[model samples]
Target: MKNTIILSILLLIFIFNTEAQKSAEVISIGEKVTFFSKTLNEERRIWIYVPDQTSFQKKIEKRYPVLYLLDGESQFYSTVGLVQQLSQANLNSILPEMIIVGIENTNRYRDLTPKVNSTPFITFLEKELFQYVDEKYRTAPYKLLVGHSLGGLLTIDILTNKPEMFNAYIAIDPSMWYADEQFLNQTISQLPKQKLTDRKLFVGIANSLPPNVTLKNVSKDKSSETRHIRSILKLGDFFSKQPNKGIQYKQNFYENENHNSAPLLTQYDGLRFVFDFYQSDLSEKDFQDSTSLIVTKLRNHYQKVSKGLGYSVAPEEEFINYIAYDALGKKHFSKAKSLFILNLENFPQSNKTHAAYADYLAATGDIANATEFYEKSLQIKDDKAVQQRLLTLTSKGMTLTESDLIQYVGQYVLDDYKITIVLELKDGKLISKVPGQADSEFVPVSKDVFTVKDKQGYNITFHKTNDTITGFTSVQPNGIFKATKKS
Candidate 1:
């Protein structure tokens, strides 16, 4: 009896340890570093986050993609969290796990800009900053450069002159026309008729100037600032008209978000555009039924758009494959696998697609195929999180349990706006549906707090009186709406 009790205690401890190891781990807080600049001859500071590779599986050994961000002090944490959450959600697999470098500014004008006649400091980025980052980090050839305001101007300069430096570029409210109207007009004249190949650029314009402001050259009343804004828009219009061959370009005009509030919206939209293929809206079923036909149709569609717009559409396989993985997360296994195979034909380099397919294989108890694809994904990109998830799925058997139905349905009303949320139980899962939107399965984050993986823009919480739900609050992207359940 004594031996049996001791053995039972040991078994319990082992099980607990195994379970703990299977859970996901949060990314480590990034480090701050300051380096001497050669261009401006001043010190520049930056924030850096390396993915949690320590937890990565031993089978995978590889470097990762790099993202260079401006406004390090203000937006670093938010961008990092967004990348992690988006990747975890697997929404269209639009983003890949990579290192993020946030460049902190010593003097905004000196480092972020390309030229400064009024300011004493020269452009640090042009002189020594870019070389410094390359030397310090284990960066890959595939890199994305992001900036806003003066930084945005620098991004444009790089795109215009040294396009080979980075794979992707994002500029938010760039001061492109700051050098003067003559400089912008000259730049437009010098633009090449041919499209840039194998490159991507995203430009965002905010609601800084009123809509009534006239931009024509013949305008009688013109201020220097107005001319500046006009020049930037003119350049935007130019890019919009250019042919699509080697380059993919997009422009976003934010009427609601001003210059100060534009960064958040721009960052999200810019990333989405650069990774457009990964964030496609196609359903997994679409890919499974006819992968070849879908790819052909998409290619033809892009060819037409490219000819008319002067830029290439995102690769079809990447978009389809990402959609498949997303479907799998919602428990559609066969659909996910079919999409993965289709995507592999187009984007053989995408490791995320393989990893997602591996997950589907594991779910159906196809251990051999699951292991193969898991290793394949790791080979392309060393993703530790995926490896850990695989280990959990394989080792501990998971069982789905149904929960009892509860009454928590009601109409939520706020000032000037109304949102009706219906709470229903389906197969033991609490599902919430909003009018005109798709139903979302909510996972209880807390006793009364529930979250939907499908929607990041809102938070839904319920208030209960005794065993009955009395009221519920619906938090949206812009504002919050509260409603009491009708008695």
Candidate 2:
């Protein structure tokens, strides 16, 4: 048994490596775009990352919020990856997927710093970049701006002077000591008067203090070495004391992180703070209880989130579908029905939404409505599994009894490949297991046909002769292969 387990582990590793090798291709995160800036009167190169629309099941074109980043060449990749991870991976849904537009600097001082109350950079962004991005991409009204060091100074300047430009701002260790702390003083005075309602600002202060200095004594030192941190601390303290209109604000001090290493962590924290209402945490009890009022709760949550984001936000179709299915599985039919209907109403064009509703209907024994919904789903996309399901529902001699399914359960072998498959009945579901592979659950489409769950375009068809089980054939996209019954 020990030897067998070791060999099985090695075989699994070999298969994984082989699959990885097959998928070895150039992985690109974002694209570099160049356009002439009429405001600046020169060409500017920007890096852009837009979420792939094809990966989503919604047939309707999706629009996304945009995040504008300063120092595009350096910050573009990490920001893009962070957004993708937070929004897309493992159903995280912490933040909404956003388009990242990073502006590569031509001259840091000329573009990012204010020259005698004139902001040519702000003018360029407002007149040129905003128009370009909105025209070229499917962008929502929401926008965010992030900057560090001198860029952070420019960000603060924008927030104080032109607060309407971006919905949220992140300033990472800004050089507030510029020009005898003029912008810093201006920001402190102006912010209290400006009614920045629904707007957000996140300030990240890095440890710029000397080895001997601490937060308590740093305010007294006032040396050029501690000037950077002192200015930031002063600004933070003012924010804590003063009532800054209606703008949401947060600040963090990274004791061990310096200017260069602070931006990444700050960006993550800033995004979370800005969009804390994005994900609704639904507990397991909510799924198990039919009277939990999940539908009402979800509606109210999304409404609040929509208000915060300045858009009409709906719960994600996939999220709703998963919850609906969970309710259906737990036999909470009424709860499942309401959630499924809600999903359909929100995502009318989504194929998965229609199919999920169909599944709920089928489970509740509403065959006619289930068939209609499945057909509606197929009208949007040609899904083989749905097609098979429809065929099985309509066809005669396809619906099997428990005893009929039991006859097909046993061991089968492919002599040529030396492969064996064991089919077993577990909780009224057929399960298939092969050596060195994970067990796959089968969804019965017909008495003889079963589709592997989560495995697209793959089916197993059992053959019989003389009222006895003979064998089965594995039908895959590649080809159909036969296996002989061993029991």
Candidate 3:
């Protein structure tokens, strides 16, 4: 009887544990959450996955980088699966663990593009939608933006107009010539002559169009059967000629893939490009034994690849330089400085290397050199966050009193839609808040001009009426609106 009772208890415990495990995995691979959006005039749905690390003890303290995916309904499962496999793969530690936030499209044309035309089914993605996601998620400052097809075009638009919106950008077969080539031409004209700082951009092109299709004939067939191969080629050439500096960029033409088939291969290649060094076979021993020898060998390898592809070296500094930064976080300043200089030598135009070196110098009390390099880094790109840091350091003795007029902000109501703005202070900095969240700090670019550090590519302008900060305007590529202080 005693043995039988013990066996029964064991069976019950096993059943209970099995049920618990099944319950934990019950959430669909791409579960959707409805978020209220004034920009879309309705509740917007987004797909999200918190990493499965919650089940592991070692991963309990880890916070992950966030990857905002475009076309969530279509690509979320594939990307989430890819991220999980690649990050955990020993052969390709090319990507870190990241929280995948798939932004579902209620209207792709409207939310992704900066401008809205008379297109029958289009939606716009203003600051309202972006703020909603950030407030609702535990996002890190490090972010990667991704898109494919029309989504790819949207990715380019976001990076070009608001480079600060994401730390890295990946676009797969982006429709470069869409909207009468509106975004393409705009990007070409506004392509900054200076280097981008601490930024990485990767674009891929594939045999997406059917044979012999041209952009000029796109209007002839409105059936979505037409492929604009010529236009994609033109875009490829344009991106190829774009100068490389603070931004490390590359373009790949997948001869074997079409527009629909391109995303899979392009995504793999793009992630490799973004995190090249993470997959390097180098070990600590290799660096310690012969640092110069390893760098030389790597340089040779880069040269061969660049020559074969008719392009320059892959921006090795962008990925390799992170090693030094990681070391510095542990207070190994000397090692960090050495790596920073090496990265600068490899990628002279990269503003990140310079900025990182400046930080190292500043930490060591070498103020003059630090200031010089910091200025040089700023000259590469008009990044608002970098500008603010430089301002505080340069004007060390200046006492600046900034107020959060963002709080007295009000709603911009458009018919059935409403946008809520809140202001507060955090970490000794003034921040703007949208509905459903608290305020975070804003980085000032110029006098009365400020932007978010994570980019999101928003500009907040305060309005003064009768000597009171009564209103403000938040501007993005989609549209502009004036919000008055709510009484």
Candidate 4:
């Protein structure tokens, strides 16, 4: 009777659910890369998130920094999510776009332990994994490694022995209590000898104390669970007094979180702590204060960042255009021009950049040069927005009126094809209506040329011979079609 009642309830719930019929789509997070280790004589599958460049033109020349993640199967998705969210153009923009390489573990015990003396993992990483990623993807010289728990224990090993493997290291809630805390001793002794240079480290210490025991009093209560936190605190103490100014090190203690829950916040703080110079948040007053100096400040900022990253880092094109568009909106023509030109100099081949510069030129009363840029932009890539802008400038003094929209309001039929196109004038706009299709509004860019709004067909160019409108060419995605007015 209970099973029958439960089944009946489930059936009723399913019947009421509108979304029950929908099938879940499979999401491919990243591609799998197999790294064959010559030293260890083993094969390992690695998960890598390379930037999607199939739609981007000339992507072969682009390169990005790499963020190597340990314990990949457990943390790859979370790290990838953070990378996408923070590196977006309009969002946080705290970090540069990086290729996230997550190393999936086949066996955790042999590879990640310091006591087993499995120094072969270092050979696998420096030789096999690093080379595999660099050769397969467009990667920069700078690299960052993030690890947690057992992974963090391994991270400390590489930071001590193979310090040149990565530019920055993040270790979260490591099992420093392993084998009588020998790894803690290694960190203490090795850090003093290592020349830190530009290397950075961010340590995340989680609160795994017993209930009712505060951090201040946890040291006195020697329990088996508290041993891990105690070892991490000892390492933190050594990091605090490490007299190397060249090495950048910071420790964040999360009193609310435990060992497993600390990684989410740890990875976030670690990235921000390492790449503090990547964010370029400028207030309105910064641009308004001195129109001429804004662009200069931006250039100097990126220049300093490039020196630190050991590569020539250019400011993102979207960020520069964001500032430039803001300047243009505020009527600061000089600042707008300077910022836009600087972007064009940095990213001359970008279609959107060219279109932005063209808009600036047209606004500043430079029609001749604006046309030149619009043509250049169209040459690189033809966009309906750019095409409409170009036609607007070229078709000067020829404006479309409501009465003019009425002339094309009749049925159009193509002789070769059996398709019929109908245009109707509605509310001072010409809308196209076809059988089994949604209505699309035509926005007038010129007297006889129109671009349909809401991602419909392309430009509709009217054809006339001796001042008589005969037919129009409808630009479709497949190909162009001509239809003569029928009745």
Candidate 5:
């Protein structure tokens, strides 16, 4: 009687599920798009992830390299997350930001194996997929391909036969015993013929043998179950002994991990090796030694990276701008000048670069060049901040000479507010400091009038009696206050 009642309940629930499904809500995690491919006479679907518009900076368009992944349905989410975590999190930029394209397979055996003549799939990638993506998104010329298992076999095939398709290739635990070692023998024979300069390949080997079998004696015992591991071992040995074909190749053996649990770690290791030239380090002494030396090292480092990537890669404009402002604040004028000028050369079209250069000039009291770059920046983009700065500079009685600025350097105190402000001249610029607070810079806007740098709507004006400095008035958003000159 209990079983009969349970069956009746289940049958009623199933009958009513169709009606209940009408109100169901859809949960979308990410983007998936489809396009019909003429080469395969079928529709293809792919998952894509690109950096957010604000990932790098505001109003700056940046292009990134593409990483084409196989087995999209299973690998898409983890790969995208890994790329984001490595490139953007915790002040760590171990890898360059990239666009990830995961290709969803329609038929694994038909599309991923050379035995099934996967030429049409390759044709679809080259003729249809590449063109479609290039036309739709901002992509750098450099490309990387990653595959696992049978997909890994396909990856190796592409590296051997179509070396120019991608700049880097990662094969994770490939089934090398496919079709009686035909693919393996073909790869070994064709590898010597291909010129792999400026290319990189990373192969990951997983432990696929029985619990009792080990690397030392597994080779002697040839069983059908052990064929996969032996075949991968042979390919690894070939790579080790072969003459240098200009390809940067590496193979990693994961003894503790099995075939099913290797792709995650393998992908991480593979990317690091392929992009070994990308990350750069600097010592404290390097920054202290010479500013020019820092610039030279950066140039040389990117040059090496550019050669490896087969494209021109400039130092990021934001990095240069940050260090420039840092040097300017530290009174390292020469260092700041070099960094600012480098940005102007590398990113001539960027309004931020021009505006930043204008800020440096304004801080250093070069009114003419500052005015020129500020106008140039406005011409490119109508930024309200830049426009306000230009308006302030062009206003009458706003320009003040260094000699005129030197007169106002003195200690002052606001008795009513119980606040003390100290002013000093360093590198021909006025710096203001309050006890237990960070130092503030004062940029001259007019005779005896100044604006606090980087702080909006804050200004100070000085009063004089018989050409002698007396006191100053502070203007802020909240209210106006007065400070008397103490020294």
Candidate 6:
């Protein structure tokens, strides 16, 4: 048993290495790196967070938006965690999965100041680092900039001067009072003049209150404690009134949060607000809805989503599968069939999809078609459970010609349940599709007593006369069941 287990582990490793598409394993957290910058002429350490990759069989290619967050060294972990959690399929789908580029600051004041040229740093980001990230990683054309305090002030500068640098901007308790509010004044002046189509801005204001002061009282106070809060509010008010130059915008005030603690809440709300349409909100009733209306709604929703993202987007595979199964469970066969067929067309290469389609077909009494797809699935990727399922009710071995399998192809009905099993010969292979079940391919273990393929020892003993087979017995785990040829 020990040797067998070890051998199985080795075999699995070999299979994984051979069959799985080659790519870097998904990093749940992120990797810290020291990257040399040509624009800044210095080596910088940054943290990078990439989303967990899609299943290899799901897509041939994919890309994601990049969110460049300021103050990497301090905020990388929490930011990455927020992205990972929110983007999970089972969780809220409001925020699309994105790559988080945590930019570590070597000189915060030098780069994030409105008083300085800071063009070199901007050039480093816009030209050097941005290009590097896009070239090296799978990133979409859209980029979002996120910052806090002084970093937020820099965010405003870029938004005002080079609006095209990023598609979206989030300023969390930004020091709008920087350089005596010079950058804030620039934002107020330039925001209305720019062609802001397809652009968005989110501002999060932290409550900067001295003891005994309130949100209402802070606006009235001329004291320094209220300066940061006052500036952010003024900017938010200004942004809200900007003409419809096609930009989407919103501002959130965290009354309980001060400058130091605002990023935590604002970051979460900012992401939720910015990419609100990214998630699907399929209710239980929607799942149980009949095929035509439900599919149309889903398709339309994703179409609008695709238009927004500047790329074609589809309903998540799992979400579709869930609806399909729910329809199937409710006996909505037409809806189930349509969804299964649609899913199969979208992801024909996926083993899971094939198995699902095959299941639907078999359950619907389309045994021959089910078996064909099941064989296709197994050929693409070996699945033992499927093999056992195919035999205990079903590959690698000596190949058999089409002529050799023709003898095994027939319809046989079981004695007790009177269940009819379909045997088929396709593309030089023999297949078994049991009643209301998936197809399993057969292996030629021997002449008359050939064992089912990939069954982990399950065999079918055939009763033959010369070259013609009369019947066969299923060697499954429950018990042996005999069947005679019906035609």
Question: For model 4, how does the per-residue alpha-carbon lDDT over 283-345 read when each residue is reduced to its tens digit?
Answer: 667867537688888888888789778899888787689889988988889899998999889
TM-score of 6: 0.69
Task: Give the CA lDDT, 0 to 100, for residue 408 in model 6.
Answer: 80
lDDT at 378 for candidate 3?
71
* Cα displacement (Å) at residue 415, model 1: 92
The residue-by-residue lDDT of candidate 2 on 1-487, one tens digit each, is: 9999999999999999999999998777778899998878899999998887313443247788999999989998889888888988776789998889999999888899866567888999999999999999889999999999999999998999889999999998999999889989999988887779889999999998898999999999968999999999988888899775788889999988999999999999999999998988877777678863999889899998899889998987777788888888888888889999998889898888898888887776655456567777887898989888766654322356667679878998975786988989887666888999999876666546666665555567778898788898876667788999986
| Per-residue C-alpha lDDT of model 6 across residues 381-421, encoded as one tens digit per residue | 89987665454322333456887778788899998888888
Choose the strongest candidate by lDDT. 2
TM-scores across all candidates? 0.50, 0.72, 0.49, 0.69, 0.75, 0.69
TM-score of candidate 2 to 2 decimals = 0.72
lDDT of 3 by residue, 433-468 (tens): 666765555555433445454434355566666766
Error of 2 at 125 (Å): 1.3
lDDT, each prediction: 0.64, 0.85, 0.64, 0.81, 0.83, 0.77
Which parts of model 4 are misplaced by more than 4 Å?
Answer: 1-25, 51-62, 115-118, 211-225, 286-290, 371-487
Against the true structure, candidate 3 has what lDDT?
0.64
Q: Worst lDDT window (10 residues) for model 2? A: 53-62
Residue lDDT tens for model 5, 1-487: 9999999999999879977898787743357899999999999999988866216443236778899998988898888878878876664567887888999999888888875345788888888999988887788899999999999998998888889999999999998889999999999998889988888999999988887999888889789989998998888889999878788889898988889899988999999998888887766776665465788888888898788778888888888888888888887878888888889998999888999998888888876567667767877888999988876764522545668677888889986887888898877678999999899878766567766666544557789999998988877656788999886
Q: Once model 3 is optimally superposed onto the true structure by TM-score, how far is the C-alpha of residue 398 displaced, in angstroms?
A: 60
How many residue pairs clash per model?
A: 6, 0, 10, 0, 0, 3
Cα deviation of 247, candidate 3, in Å? 2.1
Worst 10 contiguous positions by lDDT, candidate 6: 52-61
**Which parts of model 2 are misplaced by more than 4 Å?**
1-23, 53-60, 290-292, 371-487
